[model samples]
Target chain A: MANTFLDRTALNDLLNGACFLGGGGGGPMSGARPLIDLIVKEYDGVTLVPYDSLDPELPCAVVAGIGAPDAATHGPSFSSAPKDAFLKLQAVSGTTLGAVLPGETGAMNSIIAALVAAQLGLPLVDVDSSGRALPTLSLAAYNLATEPTVLTLANQPVTDEQQATAVIETRTAPQADSVVRALLTTQAFEQEGAFSTWLMTAGQLPGASVDGTVTRAIAVGAALREARAAGDDPVEAVNAVLDGQLVRLSCGTLTAFSSHEGGGFDGYTIVLTDDDGHVVTVSAVNENLLAWRSDSDAPLAAAPDTLAWLAEDGTPLSNTDLRGLTAGTRLHLLGIPAAPILRTPLLAARFAKELAGIGFFGQAPRLD
Target chain B: MANTFLDRTALNDLLNGACFLGGGGGGPMSGARPLIDLIVKEYDGVTLVPYDSLDPELPCAVVAGIGAPDAATHGPSFSSAPKDAFLKLQAVSGTTLGAVLPGETGAMNSIIAALVAAQLGLPLVDVDSSGRALPTLSLAAYNLATEPTVLTLANQPVTDEQQATAVIETRTAPQADSVVRALLTTQAFEQEGAFSTWLMTAGQLPGASVDGTVTRAIAVGAALREARAAGDDPVEAVNAVLDGQLVRLSCGTLTAFSSHEGGGFDGYTIVLTDDDGHVVTVSAVNENLLAWRSDSDAPLAAAPDTLAWLAEDGTPLSNTDLRGLTAGTRLHLLGIPAAPILRTPLLAARFAKELAGIGFFGQAPRLD
Candidate 1:
């Protein structure tokens, strides 16, 4: 299990599964696919190693993109930029990194870790800080993970074209998260649409990373792809992959939608009305945070509990894609339990109030 | 002159003169004086050296406070914070700095250079990037300084309760300036107000720094103080120090005033109507940029020209203090020539259009 090598099928499945888990964030695969494809082709294959198998003293870096998910979908035409930030982290930390972990598991991030690992000739850990995509760095699973021996170094390079130029070194994950959040407001980064964030180490992976999430995402993708090919309902295939945890909430048409971009987030509220006159309102900053029934004040779903909305045909859409949704646009809503690590009382309290501030609230999914 | 030591009288004179030359910016001396007095009292004396007398290969830094000049006037008592940016510059540049130059001649910056020099055991160069104050880091003398065997290392320490947390290193001055400007927008700095900037070198001093400006500022201060003590008109005394170069422009009442703060700058436009019905409008973003005469498209004074507005009693006022001025408040305006280096066509063109965008335009004072 520690030496599993992902072939093309596993890679594609990982993308598909992570896209569904993105929950209207993690950016679109349109920008991520080509880069991952090139890496896989050039490198021949990528390694996925369990954190427990790695040397406990070896450091690991968390690799993920930062910014509004939609930025990549716009006209900028992103090429596979050099991994200067990755190399910078290595240089600044003065530590030789043995592996890289996904900062989160989502549309782009799940594969991004693999891509960086392939480029660096290192293994992609079978874990991530966020088992599912969530907005804001503070929500990173590594931030919530009990403190370990590893330190997080956040590096942003001053490339010729981009204006983001910052490097923060800190022992505390909260301080690292806070400083990078502040950097997001700079004139350059505020407009960056998508930037990169690299954090954590292999030693912290056992405690900080959501275990086996990479493999789980790939499994979800494989199930859906296989079911669709077999002439079975792909939506049902996704539900089966989650062990009946994917709860079908509603099927309706979007009646209203509005969003504003600020503080490095695209905040939006979506209203949907079913044919039977039932209404559902979903609020989100990047990922969908909460879903509420028309007559009930309580949340039907909340973060770190995830509410994923998709076309009935099972096309996963990011927040940017949601912008195109109009009145009478049909969609299906489903809820899934968040990663077990995020459900603990201590971790839940960390972002619960912030989640409520954006009109999202409810208990996170607890461990069985 | 290269080894001249600044005594109490010279230090006081520097403040007095810099206030007059600030062009209604550079912050007030209220906050700076105490810091300088403490350093001077503790150290006994601070060294002042002329740039031409120094070794050509040695590097120097331009040190000055950053942010809206008015911020220090508000709360958050500042003690001698560590010169991490200074130490960082030395560290990043990998050079032993020979001296430090004041970024500009201003209320606070005049003394700040000396204070840092005393703390670091370095001499204060008798030169500055700006002969007088202008807004924005790009306008700093070293930023405009043509060339010298020097590299700039801009450091900003994220301090809380006056303790610095981190330092960002870069070779480019604008990038350093940009990063620091962004830092100013952060919560701690936005309220902390006066941050510090150290850039340039002693070698760049000949081309970039205004030579003899330190002595000149002191002379101006001494003349004003002497006249006030002698019961002579202090305003007239200031004119005599400039050898009649200070042209009395108008004696008027403020008829209208408006300002906005953005990018850590207080941008304002002031309208003054003279007793004889002559009207003048002045525009500034931190430092006065232009003075427009009644019905004239041309400017009476422009950057890098100096326009000083003072109370009838000859007290110089920064833009922050002018915020308290009422529609019928009487004041006097005078225009002085800018430094010779700033008058160069190359340097003047750099910011001329930006100055014009803010409604400031005119030819700088030419050397006779």
Candidate 2:
């Protein structure tokens, strides 16, 4: 109640948190600002009920539009093709949402939740199915709990609709992944693919899937703000709160960072040598696949472990925006575990496979 | 009738044409093939109907799935998403589909049209809104007639009968685009960030909008096939067919090109010195966004003008593959006027102004 009614500040905090949990994706102040501003202007800070306290019986819908970031960024006029799918699922399952559900914990997902909730007049739930980034719907931890395939997908501005054929529905999760991959292949060819990347899974939609990840993100963001205001290293504060460490490493400028290169990012790698006769390396192609420490014998972080790389030298490196990485450029390598993402369909073994050509000094670590 | 009476080999040619028409963004041939194959398998190539021969009074629906390509590309399972939206739209408009309509020229779009036509017992139209490739439905030429804002987006799976709000009726294309963009932001932050790039648009769906880009592409492709069978260079043959010429450019190897390093992407410039000592320098960060004769001040193929880059030497580039480019390479640049993409409420001068930085070169080209 306080977060929504007591203060309007929560929206900003939530959006920032959403961005972090976005795992290099999702919207934040940039995307959420417009919607939030509109809400404040029109409704004067509509009190959003927290997911924990919201009534489950209320007939609300989890509204989400899934597609490519380029489509959303370059072509914002096309209504995402997935919202219609959500509605159909609601109708078919006889489940009516009293509130809109956040698809993930990222800033974009959280703010979208806020926007959808505000638009539909449903209280927003801070809960998201995947606490971290994933590749498809089957990766939803709640997949054991919900339908593997979404009910419907539609684009309002585009005026198009699709119904998955018999081939897509009956397939297994990985098989489904291939189907989605095929669809993406077309988009990839055109460099304009867009569709629902995250899925509701087979289980998880109703109960177990709903976690207040957004709330957690907001709180962390608020604390970071306070820490920054206090002249404290915001990174350190974030590290402490997230139960991680704050380390500074300059591993040359990023030579190449890819978002559209592979499935679920498949993780990325940064090549650099550290001081003190150490050749340190970090890879976060998809969800921080792994990290190699100074000594080749030891693994810093591995698949199933979550790792985030920030510019320890104070240069921000969100989602591998490494366009002009050069030799001798200072960069920080934040090694976090990959467990957060390992929860999805992508396994540590797969991560190992993706980085095979790159050849690591040590054996790839297994998942928890 | 001859074209419709396609054998396996002929169908492959058609698919190739469709792929070219798809403008590098289309789904796997497997999904599309089976649908046509199923028709052929069951009916032994029942009288194939061309778009011109379709019954004018017959109701039709342009269809394609709007979700992560990987997920939708699954083996084959019908879900509720697109079908729900399709049925809902059919009911809302009080118009039933007389035939299957393809929204764009992409290979998948054509296949989707064929699949729906085969399954629904409708004829597949040969016309498309765009004669070339575009990212959104708003770019379709159909919107040139009336900028319809209210769009009914839906998703229907093969088996589901339940349909309701799965169809979204929006009053404005931008509004729908906004909602869909937000939804995609959620999905990208969650998983399918890379794949969720392609989408539909108002201009794409409604009017003469690349209504049958696929069919036309197939036609062009057929010409190329003829040229190839006759041992002519595919490039020269295609150039002649499109009323265009193939300048040298390679996507696989970016060449000695560095145009700009802002936003993202390895921005670079391709320098081509014509035999006349006339130099044309093309710059691009991703796809060829701008092309101009560098020696002179005149603009080359601008924004609305679509350009396809070739790989090293003369390898034809598939728009879907990103690996088409490598380091330190020679290339060719082919300039083609953007197929007619009808202007929509969301994509008029105002929107074009916003996108001016990309240098969309062509004026809103009109078709005969």
Candidate 3:
């Protein structure tokens, strides 16, 4: 894929696509929207460069916010956390990062990387550690790497009294994930903070990340926008963009939903009823983990497979957006196959634990 | 005071004295006893040097364990945490510390500093950040310094699965204290870890620490031991060592005791009745905070004044040891004034918040 400039229209579409691909969690579009607007207004647009185009030895790090999406409203805004984390990582590691990579694919997480890259006058790599939003760092592709993961977290304190940052260096991804989650509960963070992780040279990116995710999100978003303008089925347009990989699992109503927020995640269970009276229950921890019909023991899809909800206007709704959804509201559930890199045994083992957490005990099945 | 080598007997005495001075918290004697024994057996013993004797510009730092004393029983042994924290601080700060200082005076906390100093072949400074064990870093004399406090925390994992370290740097003592406390709740720590903080040069130490605290503890311990061997009143011997500063407040029975542990602290309330039927109650969070007679409005003592309990044999009983006593067990309560350096306006402001936390809204009373 060629380099791209994220102008206003393109940035909006990318956010829409990334939110849908966020598979329910990612981050709130409301948070990403204003940040994107500010980025475009100030710097015109961020430059997105393909990962392979950069020098193989150029150091880079993944940047994203790590915490419960719902908790963001309660504390300091994350406007400065990403930049702060980025600089702190550089300071602690004694390496000058050449570019910024998205830690995961989410409206805010992805755009935040772009914002950091733009603000620092560095290129935003057209790739991400996870092709879709994941609840923990363990599920990201970079976790499969053999190198140590050094994570730096920064919280923008609401007042001058709170602690601003911490650096965690560990030999494994799971340990890093565990430590970061624990920090979110601290008085300084309060279940919300930004982080930079997976510091590595450009040569290591191809083996540890999903390439073209940024472009893919933009393409999917463009399709959604074009379909909405032409008054066509946006879901069908999105499926076409994925070469018919999107599985239309069910068209139903939001009959029931309950959410519990803690441990740096917004865990929820959603119950929906199809027009044919089939009931489906979905379980999630930040991102959608599993979906299954009540009448069948087999799951419709599990994590590592994109599980999404589309509104009547074909706009993607994140779990944050789904919270305000009322009973009987029309919603379409779609499942898109995860990036092939995410289906490997290494990544599968990580997702299995998360899926098992919500009652699904089997390996995540491929959607396409 | 002259520099002293910590022989086995001296080390034991130091532990006893530090535990007595720990007020109530400073870490449990049981934990410190074995470690001190091991240190003496392996390295012969630690070396203690007066703080001012070192080159005025030599870099140094304080090292100690930070967490609930009770929680230590459930997690990995902290035998290596102090050393780990010390090395990590040196690595992150890029400064070769010339000596080690005790973060606070406690049986385990004080001894751990000696352990780190011995292991690193560095001198253990006689001065301490707090003359007595304090519940939080905010109460330390070093908190009064204008320089930033860089704190490094390390947990020795039970298995190879946990993240072992974190570095926290902040402009104020409270923020550093808050961040470290938050990290204790993480899986990597679980309320027990070692930390090194207050990184500075020897020139900065005199203004930010209490001098001769180590020797003072040793003297107190020697008095207790000598009195016990002589079949004399150990409390009176201790008072004599302190130049009559120790006040015999009450001799009573442990009628009631309750403890609640969380947030890296073991909070408790104890009640006792003197021989004259006077009822006294003591409140503590790790270390004893306040003691008052139920019949009188004035507190017998409040931290940073030391409230201590002595057994029939004249041995100092830490709050951890007090937990095992049955109702009606005989005990003596003594009050010792805090070091003059701890009574400054700057340190008082920090202690006020902690005192207010347990329902004491007024200023900490001067025990003398």
Candidate 4:
């Protein structure tokens, strides 16, 4: 696989196309777009390396924002926070950083890693910790094992210009999730935060990450654009580009949508009525965790499968983007099977309780 | 000026005596006493080094509990959290820790340094970051400069029994304060947390810490005990032991006392009516920040100064201890001028805003 140089033009394509690939999480593109544009315009181009080319021992930092996607709309928008987190780890560990990987596959987080790679002059690894956006840190591939996932929060209060960073080192993924959640609820953090996690090496990338996610996201995004230009449904176009199945779950007019911010995340419950007069309820704690008929024991889809939403024109909608949407807005729902690494019994057992805690009562949807 | 070995007896005296010196903060004695006793008994007596006898270049870590003193009543009662924090600093910095200093002077924090020292077989430096307990991290003498303060929170959850450690490294005191406050508000940390902070060297102690606080606490506590035994006034004995003048602010029955937990500290307001119908109000965010008499524009005492309360029998009272007291209970109030270092404009200015934010409407008291 040849490395692609993402200049301003390719950067624009990735930014616009990645939103649909975000799987209804990854925050809204509006918050991160301008900064991404500015950085890409200034730098010659960002190098997007394929997974096979990375040296196993080369250290890489996974960067992403961890807060309500809406919160990123205010400030620190796609700035040096990710790069600073990477440098802080390097400075603390006395090790040099060699690459950058997005913490998750999302329109915003995915490209932010590219920006970091450009700023640092490092290769953007074609892999990510999560193949799609995940609400909690525990739901990721790198943390499924016993290795300590180090999380760094770079929160700069608007009132106090002093940027504060918190590094949480924990034994388990759940513990890291709890610590990150705690940081979000604290008075000092302004109710939201951004973070970089799973600092590891290229050698560990194969085992620690969902391989070749960047290329897939870019390809799907480009396909979506081409299909839309040719008067074809982008859903079908994305399906052709992605390896996993992207199933159209339902088409409906949203009858109701409501959400509240708590425990460092926005928990939302939405009701969409299909043309057949069937109502489907979706419950999400940050990401869309589960969806089921208004009257059913089994869920149509449950985490760690990817759940996504789109507008009539096939534009991807993040939860933050959905906030502006009204009860009568027309939408399309899609569900994609999770990556093979996320389907393991070990990871499923860990996520079962948290999913159920947030009103996900059904068993995890597995595609063996 | 020689270093004293704190045997079982001195450790007991220090533990009991330090509670009163805590100035209504530093957590409660109940959570720390047994742990203190166990460590001193097991070790060949902890070494307590006076500032004058120590080499200034020997690295020291200031240790204390960072959460609500009352919350320590639950599980994780003096686990290996403190020692773990010390060891983490050693591991990260690759510097051998030679001494320990209390982050603040209080019932629990005052003695936690001794416990850490005993556990590590290091000397306990007879100095503290603050001469007495102050609520916010920014109020300490050591943090007045732009030096980095490395803070670690070792919280062992009651449910999981897994210890979660958060390490925050920042350039300024306020940044460290914000980071620590965020950690407390996070779900990973319990409602209250204990931490070790400001890892520095023995040589930096002269410039960084309020000098001889451990010795001062010991002497004041010993004086109180002696006064009670000799039927003399314990308050007067404590006054003579401290260098600054101790003023008897009021003698009154507590009319009303109420507080609520917010932003990781207890914000409290109490009113006391003297026999002559004079009402005095004290405001505290963890530690008493200001006290004012009714109809007086000037406060009786303010932050940086030591404002303390005791029972008529001279038992030192923590805010947690005060919570259990009923209305109309008789208590004695004393105001001790702050240590000279904390009274400096540089440190006082840093604490002014936080004190005011917690309803304390007075200047930081100065001792010229």
| Candidate 4: residue B237 lDDT (0-100) | 80
List DockQ for all candidates: 0.01, 0.01, 0.01, 0.01
Which one wins on TM-score?
3
Two-way TM-score contest, 3 vs 4, winner: 3
Candidates ranked by lDDT: 3, 4, 1, 2
Better model by lDDT, 1 or 2? 1
lDDT of each: 0.68, 0.46, 0.82, 0.73
lDDT of 2 at A18: 52
Task: Give the per-residue lDDT digits (tens) of candidate 2, residues A44-84.
Answer: 55445555465444544444434343334443332232344
* Candidate 4 structure quality by residue, lDDT tens digits, B241-334: 8654887888898887777775677767777887677877777777877776654434666767777887777677777778777766788878
| Colliding residue pairs in candidate 1 | A60-A201, A60-A202, A66-A195, B62-B199, B66-B195, B129-B141
* Chain A accuracy as TM-score for every candidate: 0.87, 0.69, 0.96, 0.93
lDDT, candidate 1, equals 0.68
Q: Model 4, stretches more than 4 Å misplaced?
A: A1-368, B144-146, B157-161, B326-328, B359-368
Ranking by TM-score: 3, 4, 1, 2
Displacement of residue A270 (Cα, Å) in model 2 is 4.1
Q: Write the per-residue lDDT of candidate 1 for residues B1-368, one digit (tens) a residue.
A: 54778888888888878888888887766756786676678887688888888887777776566666667566333334324446665776677777877778887777877877888889888887767886766565565553212232232324445444335455555555566666666665662333334545456566666788888888888987787778787778888888878877678998877777667667777878878886777777778876766544235666777888777766667667787766567888788887777766656665665453452222333323
**Model 4 CA lDDT for position A250:** 77
Deviation from native of the Cα of residue B345 in model 3, angstroms = 1.4
lDDT of 1 by residue, A104-204 (tens): 87777777778878889999889877678878666767765443223322223345665234566655545655565566556655433232344454666
- Candidate 4 to truth, TM: 0.50
